[model samples]
Target: MRNAMTGLALLLALLLASGGAAGAADFPLAGTWTLTAADRITPAGVREPDYGAAPKGRLIVDATGRYSLQIFKSERTGFASGDKKRGTPQEYADAALGSSTHYGTIAIDAAAHQLVFRIEGASFKNWEGTTQRRAYDLKGDRLSYRVPTAPDGNVPVSEWRRER
Candidate 1:
């Protein structure tokens, strides 16, 4: 009985040590999140939907700190030609402006309340191989962040809810 008790105590100690390490490695934002809203705040303080009335998006953050994000305007016009390469200038412009996508590794600076995205690729070529930072807020199962202000004096905001 005494030998068994000693072994159990040793096991408990090992578990405690490993648990601490795992907890340190665990990412708070690691989860699949769905976009709830994509909005822009104008200089006049009006909040308007940036991706139409109903935006569609998904964000997947894995345990390894890699992430994939995609957001699209639900009201985007379809290409009438049914061929991407044959699209008109207006169709191409609409397609480009109607969606945002990127995949890469993410790092969080909790002290600064910032998220740094090391984009591997993006729908916008200018974002490829770039590092972008955003101020973020994470509460309960909801996460929200604000993009850098655009030249047009609009501030974009993205809100997401974790998927069950």
Candidate 2:
């Protein structure tokens, strides 16, 4: 009887340990990722090319439910005036069109494979304090998501790879 009880206790301990480790492995959304590609798809299902040939971006999501993302076209021309405040109107417009940034809290619904971003602020004032939901997939180190159609009716899909 004593030997049987000892064996059962050992088995129970091993099972509990394995279950805890599995739970940790299931939550893979916490980490820093860099954007590798971004494409726009029209409502009619036409897929456009990426934002630029060498687009650059970074995305960071903390374990504590916070995230920030910044993406910009590579090789933006510097202001000819050599002063940020003195840039020409054309330069300002070009800058705005080439880059976007936003920061906010994030929530992951693992069961649903969805991510929710509650924007606290953004470079574009119109997006301040808005909540967005995206269907996300994470495979190995690659993460991708399909953003809902924007207010302008343009759908954007972005892909990121984990930064080692």
The clash number for model 1 is: 0
Where is model 2 more than 4 Å wrong at Cα? 1-27
Residues 88-146, model 1: lDDT tens digits: 89889889999999999998988888999999999988899998899999998999999
Model 2 lDDT tens row, 1-164:
99999999998898676653545444566688999888788878888744677888999986556789998877566799988899988888768877878999888777888888899989889889999889988899999898888766778888899887
Q: Best-fitting candidate, measured by lDDT?
A: 1
TM-score top scorer: 1
Candidate 1 wrong stretches, greater than 4 Å: 1-21
